[model samples]
Target: MSNLHARDYQPDRQGTLDGIRVLDLSRLFAGNVLTQLLGDFGAEVIKIEPPEGDTLRGWKTEGIETHWKIYARNKKSLCLSLRDPRAIEIIRKLVPSAQILVESFRPGVLEKMGLSPDALLALNPSLVVVRISGWGQDGPYAQRPGFGTVIEGVSGFAAINGFADREPVLPPMYLADGVAGLYGASAAMIALREAEMKGRGQVIDLSLLDPLFAILGPQAANYRLTGKVKPRTGSRSTNSAPRNVYRCSDGHYVSLSGSIQKMTERLFRAIGRAELIDDPRFRTNSDRLRHAEELDAIIGAFIGERTQQENVAFFEEAEVTIGPIYDTPQIMADPHVIAREVIADYPDPEMGHIPMHHVVPRFAQTPGSIRTPAPALGQHNRELLAEIGISPAAYDELKLAGVICGG
Candidate 1:
C-alpha cells in the first residue's frame, strides 16, 4: 500500500568486507548495530545468541520482531545455552576461524565464563576482541549493569537537551547504544586491519559512556573556560543565531538556520523586513544571539503567516537555509526521499513488504548490499558447526545435551 521504492535481496552480491568473519555474542541494540554494519558490508556475522535469543528479538511491534528484522538482516543466528561448558568450548573452537569477536556482557562476565580476552587471544592469536560495556572494563562502575539509558543520563547528553526550565530529557531512542555501536564498528575494522598486517590481536575496550561522552564536543573545555554548565535552550544553538524551529500557519513546523551573516540578511529580505538586517539588536552574530528571542518573534510571525511548504519554497528561492520538520509519514512521502530510495520496502515473510533504511555510506565500486533477511534462531547452527569440523553425530549429541538449541 505504500509508495516507497522496493528492493530485492541480492544474496549473491559481494561487498568490500567479503571473507571477514565475525562472532557476535552481544545481546541488545549496541552489539546488534555494530554487527549489522559489518554484516551489511558482506562480513560473515554469526550471531551467537543464547537459547532465549538476543534481547532484540523480544522487542516486537504488533507481535512482529521488527527491530530484529531490521538490525539482524544479513546475519546468521546460532543458538546455544551458554551456561554449559561445552557451549563455551564450541565458541573457543569457532574463534580460530573468526577474525573478530564482539560481546556486550558486563565487565568480568566473560572472564567468569572462562573466556577472558587473554584466553580468546590464546586460542586465536589474531582475533580482534571488542568488549562493549556501559563503562570501561576496569572502571569503578564496571561491575554495575551497563544499560544504554543509564549511560545516556551519565554521559551529559541529557543535561544540555530540552528546555532550560524543564528537567533534563533523556533521548527517547537508543542514543548511547547507537553512538557506541558506530564507534565499535570503526574500532573493529581498525583492529582487524592491524591483526591482518602485524599478525597480532588486541582487545578494544569500547564503552557506551566513552563514545557518547566523546561526541558532546568539548563541553568540558567550554565549562572550564566559562566556569558554567551550558543551559538547555530547546532548538536554539548556543553559538549561532536565528536558528530555531518555527511553527507555520498550517500547524506544520519548519526549521530555519541563519547562522551566518549573509544568510540572516537574506532571510530578513525574504521575510520583507530587509531593514532589520542592520538593526542594532540583529546586526552581528553576537548581537543576534543576545536578542535571539526578539529575532525569533519577528521570524516566527512571518513564518506563521505561511504554510510549511510556502515558507520552504520562499526561503529556498531566497537562497536561505530552511526546511520542513518532517514526521514519519511526511518523510516517507517526500519527493526527494522517494527519489533517493532512503526508505525501501524489502520482502518480508509476514508483512509481505517491510520498509527499512537503505545501506548507509554508499560506495561506488564495492557497495554493500542486503544479502539476506534476519535468520531464525539457530538457523545456521548446522552449517556453522560444520565449518569447524563438528560432524552431524557430534552436533546431534550437543543438541541432545542442550548445548545447542533452536532451528
Candidate 2:
C-alpha cells in the first residue's frame, strides 16, 4: 500500500518536471489536456482564465461539470480579464519565470489581445510556447470555427469509422482533441529541450486537424497506392479476419481477434474444427478474408452456444484472443484495474471521495503524483499576485477596478 509521504517512495525518486512552470491561457479539452499532461509530470501549471471563466464551466450533468474538475486537477486557477491593461501587464510579469506557455485562441485572437508568440518569446527568451488551433495558425481555413465533432468529420476520421451502410458515427469521446493534446504534450517537451540546447525560445503550432489523421495508420498509404477507399466493416478489423464482436449464450458480447495463424489454428482446434485448417478455402489469411463472413458465422455459432464465462474459460485454456465487453461499472470493478492502481482517490473539498485515473507512463525513478485537487476559480490569485510583489492594498484596488477578479 502506498502512503502519502515522500519517505514512502524511493529516496532517489523525484518529480522530473519539478522545476518547470507553465502558464495556461487555453480553454476546453485540447488545451486543458495538454497542460494536465505536464501537470501530471510535476510541472507547476497556472491556468489563467477570463473573469467570466472557462466555457466548459457550464457543461454540466445533474448541475456538475465534472469535465472541468477532471481536466483542471493539479493546477492553479487565476482569474483576470485579458481586456484590461493591468491584467495584461500582470501576465507579462509572470512570463519571464515560466518555462512553458500554452494557448488555444484562434489564429489571430492572441495577437488581438497583445499576447502573440513573438511578443511572449521576446519577454522570456528561453520559454516554449504551444499554440493550439483547429485548422492551425495559418492556412485558408485557419479562422473557421471547429469543434472536435466537426473536425472528426472534416479530417476523414468519422467517414470511415462505422458500417458502410450506416450513417457514420463520431467517436464516443473527444478523440481528435485528446489525440491533439497528447501530441501537443509530446511536442512541448521536445521543443523545450531543443530551446535549452539552442539557448532560445521556440513556438509549437499544433492543430487538432493533423494528429488524428496521421494516426489512421496505413489507410492513407493504401489509398495513395491503390486509389481505393477502405469500406467500414463494423466491429471488424479491415486488415484481418476473425476479429469481431460475438454475442454469447447469456447475451454478453465477447470480442475476439484470432488474426494470426497460430491463434487461428488454436481457435479452430478449440472449436473442434481441426479438419477445416487443411481446407483450401480456410487455409490462409488471404483466403479467410475472402470468406470472412462465412468464417465469422461459424465462430459466432460456437460462441453463441456458450455463456460468456464459459467462453472465456475456453479461450483462456486454448490461448485464443478474446475479451468480454465491459461498461463503466465493470471497468471500475475489474481486478486488473484495481491491482495496478489505475484509478486513484482524488480528494476534493467540494466533491469529496472522487475516483480518477492515476498518472500514466510511470517511471521507476521520477514518477509523478496528483499533488493538489482542482482549484476553485481564481483560488490562487491572491497568492500568485503576492508572489509577484503585489501588496494586499494594491490587489484590492485592482479587483475593485474590474481589471482582476478572484474570490
Per-model C-alpha lDDT, please? 0.94, 0.86
Clash number by candidate, in order: 0, 0
lDDT of 2 at 147: 79
lDDT of 2 at 114: 86
Off by over 4 Å in 2: 1-14
Across 82-105, the per-residue lDDT of candidate 1 in tens digits comes to 999999998999999899999999
Model 1: CA > 4 A from native = none
TM-score of each prediction: 0.99, 0.95
